[model samples]
Target: MSDEGRRTHGFRRRTPLGAARERLLEQVTPHGRTERVRLRDADERILATDAVAERPVPHYRRAAMDGYAVRAEDTFGASDRSPAQLRVGETVGPETATRVHTGSELPEGADAVVMVEETETRGESLTVFDAVAGGENVAPVGEDVEAGEALYEAGHRLRPSDLGLLKSVGNEAVEVYERPRASVVPTGEELVETDPEPGEVIETNGQTVAQYVERWGGEATYRDIVTDDEAALRAAVERDLDHDVVVTTGGSSVGERDLVPEVVDDLGEVLVHGVALKPGHPVALGVVEGTPVLMLPGYPVACIVNAVQFLRPTLREVGHLPHTDPPTIEAELTRKVVSDPGTRTFARVQVDRDGETVTATPTRASGSGVLSSVALADGWVVVPDRREGLDAGDVVAVEDWEWSG
Candidate 1:
């Protein structure tokens, strides 16, 4: 079989990066299972149901500042020229005023507050030098949040502020989506566990890919490495079919020894192979026995790119988590980057943010096998397929890598 034939299961066609991503995401079926947990334990978990407030915040009107509550009309037109003097006590009315501290309920007839700085208090009488409008310096009932209000929407991930909000709304427990379970399989004959000498390559992508899976809201399980045998690779994939998703590293390219695409074809259907993406073009997407299987290239940088570009989204969608873009910043390139016009390139760059200027310099290396290149990078800049390359000093948006912590 031709190289292209083997890669695409005899179809000999390469899918565009955007189209490939969409295709793989379409195959993901979100898990509907959820569980209840205490609000304290809900941080970083996706809400399975909307959280509603049981009672209005600040159910009763209270003072908002350290001032005396008084009827606004009584203090009207009262200034330094001729201050208005009134008696101080509860049940304030015309010619009468009350002294209520911050957060204290106002007297029944009082409708506003006179700051202490604007009032001179005597034993039983107070003189107001300034006027205040009704409801001034007061927190009305439900001013912060109303009763039955939706505090958080479904699929919202709980952050630190979210936990505080939930507690304020009287939610002791919350319903959140159960973390989806995933398995990672590393395969290749020339790979070793560790301490690889000379010709042997260490099988390190599995752990890194598994970490990504866990970071994206999945429970990841790293499987034992398999040798370069079609039957063994197929068996490993079959054993992991019960998991919500399976990710296999290495042997995804179109070579005589590359058996991932062939195994996927025999077990299920290869949805796509050979994405139009630099450093990670050998990615493959398929489904085996109703489980999504994502194939990643053996190279380290390729594994990182494919995992961030494809696997992260797939796992998030399947796990019922919100797909939110990471924070990004605009930076000027300090050096030129060359890329094929037909392929979308992701170049790692180290960003130096100084005051108003953000300088992005390409990492020391750009090879797919260089893991340190990405490790030293702060973010990635993409050169779209329509552009041949990016020139130095070009202003571009740098996307933050998926956060693992």
Candidate 2:
């Protein structure tokens, strides 16, 4: 049989997740070009170059409070019993006697600030009983950041605070990697888009996969729901190969109606299928016309899980962005969790943290069709096949939802 013909046959065995991830990384390449984008448009985009500060953050020494700017020496030894009085103009710079509010620039000859509450103000003259040290309540220039300093390093994702800092340094625009474009195709005759009239199932896997693609910094521009005909599937894959990555849901398993792998094999090469993981074990990885195509299962939860586990990482790496695993924290299992002896399992869990103690609430249904369970879940716990089950109070790593609050 030809190399392609071998892959068309049912998967021989399950591949480990670590090996699968390494292979996907090796097969995918980074995007070729970068673009300069406005700072406002750069949020969540990965930086291509280091951003240097053109000037100090504050740029000048300013008052920290609304009070009197005074020379500490002028008020030295002053007290409520033996108060020292001086004409405000003579003690400081001419016209410096004008009151200044917080964040206002300090006037010349002013070395310290005496809060308004500390001094009893009269018509033209003021009496100060308290003495303040010089330079107190002053924010010096370059205190927050130095000029010519690296504000944000390359590969940094632009967050709200990063954007604010960039704008503070007078950067209206920044250079960042362009987001990758993707196409999604859902294949199967029995599959329906949504709310099928009768004798049909709704097509939700495509939408689930598309959402995952977008959340991982890829643009899902094209989405098609097509029948299981090989010609139709081949044409869809060929048209979508123009994109950086093409994602197809359904038809990856060994079922009689499954045709995605066959079509992909005819078009290009299938790198892997039947990963050694539960729920999404039938996932397929392939390339068509030099563009990567990720074939996920038809079940909603399965599609989303596989996209996050495999496809999202590939897209993030290709865009020159860091690939981060879901945030994890050690949490106590609320109850015992049983699993198959040889296959790795991921259980949706609800987590509640109190101070340093965390509790995991395992979901009732972990099936691939239970999309609602994922929504209600705060995170997921990995159950290694070798372990019998997790006991209560045992600490386990919990992979949090991407947007967990």
Candidate 3:
């Protein structure tokens, strides 16, 4: 049996989701393009090379507090009962001290700092009430990082705080992998951008996919909607051959109007034309001119579901980014949800919290065309192929599907 309807002529065999993913991923290689970017603009960029500190942080010894810098021995054996007497001078020497503020360079011959509160100033002399050992209150060279130290290895995903550390170590720019490029093409005959007539509908899949691509650490370009003509679809696909991946929102089914698989096959090859996944069995994975192309169904929910399961991982793989799964929560099912056997299903559910009890209720609109069913739901409960259905009161792990978006 197929993922959605009765086995159709369009797809002779529907590949399992796990098998389809593995087949497509095995052909993907990490992006090799690298660019040098300034530290300020390098946040979230994947490092292309290992980073090493060229210079030591705080290259000089500095005072760590506001006080007088003096030789350690001058403040030794000093206390409230019998304070040590030291002469105030321009430079630190034997029995002499110089005033220093926090972060100030330590004066020559001074090995310690006596806090201002610990001593009192006298005419041409200073009173020390605390005994400071050598190197006390003094930050030595390379205190934060040593020169020639390894900072981050290659393939490290940089964060804002990491950039700060890189800058402090004298890095103005660094090398990073270029973000994977994607072209989102929406195709359908009865689709419009804005107001739709009685027979026409508003186009949404391309815009939705483009945004998701960006969020997944890839660069996305949303193309205008193409009609259901084979020539137009072929031209649209060929135009974006330079991108790492191309995604089409319509014309993926086996019907006469669905011509993406044929168009892709003409240029290169279709790896998998159908997948064993609910709400999106018509999904197709292919490669054209060395670039992976994902063909999604025209239905709103089906397009979104296929994009999350297939396109999301494609972007991460091509961009050399880590694929992080959305967090899940275990909740009691308020109602039973029937699923087609042998087909992986994603059931939209609204979650409610009461005191400490959490419950998930299946949404009323479960059809593939009902976009609001998934949009308004909190998360989704995945029903594996093995189970025919989930009973009421069954504890299910509901994934926060849109959390990453």
Q: Which prediction has the highest TM-score against the true structure?
A: 3
Q: What is the lDDT, from 0 to 100, of the residue 232 in candidate 3?
A: 95
Q: Is candidate 1 or candidate 3 better by TM-score?
A: 3
lDDT of each: 0.87, 0.80, 0.90
Please list all clashing residue pairs in model 1, or write none if there are none. Answer: none
lDDT of 1 at 304: 90
Model 2, position 351: C-alpha lDDT score: 88
Candidate 3: C-alpha lDDT: 0.90
**lDDT digits (tens) for residues 254-366 of candidate 2:** 87778888789888998888887776889888887778888899887778778877887888878877767678888899888877666677888898889887899788887
Off by over 4 Å in 3: 1-8, 79-82
Q: Report the candidate with higher lDDT, 2 versus 3.
A: 3
lDDT of 3 by residue, 85-142 (tens): 9989999899999999999999989999999999899787899999999999999999
Residues 1-405, candidate 1: write the lDDT tens digits.
566666456326668898989988888899898999998888899899999987777878888877778888888898999888888776688878877788888778888989988889889889999988999998988898898998888988889898887788677899999998899999988889888989899888999999888888789999988988989999999998988889999988888778987898899999998888988888899988888899999999999999988888888888887777877889999999899988999999999989999999999798999999898899899999899989999999898886643
Count of clashes, each model? 0, 0, 0
Tell me the lDDT of candidate 1. 0.87
Sequence-dependent TM-score of model 3: 0.93
The stretch of ten residues in a row with the least summed lDDT in candidate 3 is 1-10
Angstrom error at residue 6, model 1: 4.0
